[model samples]
Target: MGLIVTIIIGFFVGLIAKFLMPGRDPGGFIITILLGIGGALTANFLGRALGLYSTNEAAGFIASVIGAMILLAIYRAFSGRGRLTH
Candidate 1:
């Protein structure tokens, strides 16, 4: 139940992030889901570190999207799949 909800939300988050940051990304549905989930986790930890969220609190939607975008950027940099485009 909770997991399903998370996955669904993650999918949307990933799609939104990708749409916002236009570029050639790797993988498909599964990667999108992972990206979203990873973004949320990144936001959670980053928020906690920056005192934006409490220990047990989660990140907001906007923050999650931002995090996802950051993750996607990093992925593209490391994967070298979205560079050198004319």
Candidate 2:
């Protein structure tokens, strides 16, 4: 139940990140879901570590979206598909 909720939220986060970034991505639906989940988890953990969020709190929507965007950028950079061609 909790996992499902997380996945759904993550999907939306990932979608928003992709929409904002507006570029070619390495993967599709499954990748998006993974990216979102990863982003949310990363934000949650990093925030807690940095004292931005309490241990009991999860990452907010905006933070999650930002995290996803960062992850997407990293992914693009590593995959060597981030270059623009004319």
Candidate 3:
């Protein structure tokens, strides 16, 4: 149940981040969901390590979006794709 909730939140966070970023992102819904989930998890770990968040706490919307963007950027860089743009 908790995992499901986290995924759902991550999905929306990914979509929102993509929308906000206003760029071309490779992949479809599955990719978006994965990106979101990855971003959330990354943020969660980094925040905890930095003492910016509780161990069990989820990241805020903005942080999640930023994380997603960063992940997306890294993906593009590794894949030799162009930068994302509106």
Candidate 4:
């Protein structure tokens, strides 16, 4: 139950992040959810390692969005598929 809730929250977090940073990416509801969850995980892991976030704390909404945006930036830089072929 808790895990399901977490996923739902992650989905929304991803949606909001994507909305905030609209960019080229393979996108859909599923992808958004995955991105969000991945971002949250990334933020949590890095924050804990850097002592910015405690182990018991999950990443905040803003942090999660920022993480997602960073991931999106990296994806944009590497994926190289969004070039508008004219």
Top lDDT: which candidate number?
A: 1
TM-score, cand. 1 vs. native = 0.92
List runs of model 1 lying over 4 Å from the truth. none
Candidate scoring better on TM-score of 2 and 3: 2
| The 10-residue segment with the lowest total lDDT in model 3 | 77-86
Ranking of all candidate structures by their lDDT, best first: 1, 2, 4, 3
Tens digits of per-residue lDDT, candidate 1, 1-86, equal: 99999999899899999999998787799999989998899899899999999987999888999999999988888888658867
Candidate 1 or 4, higher lDDT?
1
Note the residue pairs that clash in candidate 3. 23-85
**TM-scores of the candidates in the order shown:** 0.92, 0.87, 0.77, 0.83
Worst 10 residues of 4 by lDDT: 77-86
User: Candidate 1: what lDDT?
Assistant: 0.91
Better of 2 and 4 by lDDT: 2
Look at candidate 2 and tell me the lDDT of residue 76.
Answer: 85
- Candidate 3 off by > 4 Å: 83-86
Candidate 1, run of 10 with poorest lDDT: 77-86
Give the alpha-carbon lDDT of every model. 0.91, 0.88, 0.81, 0.83
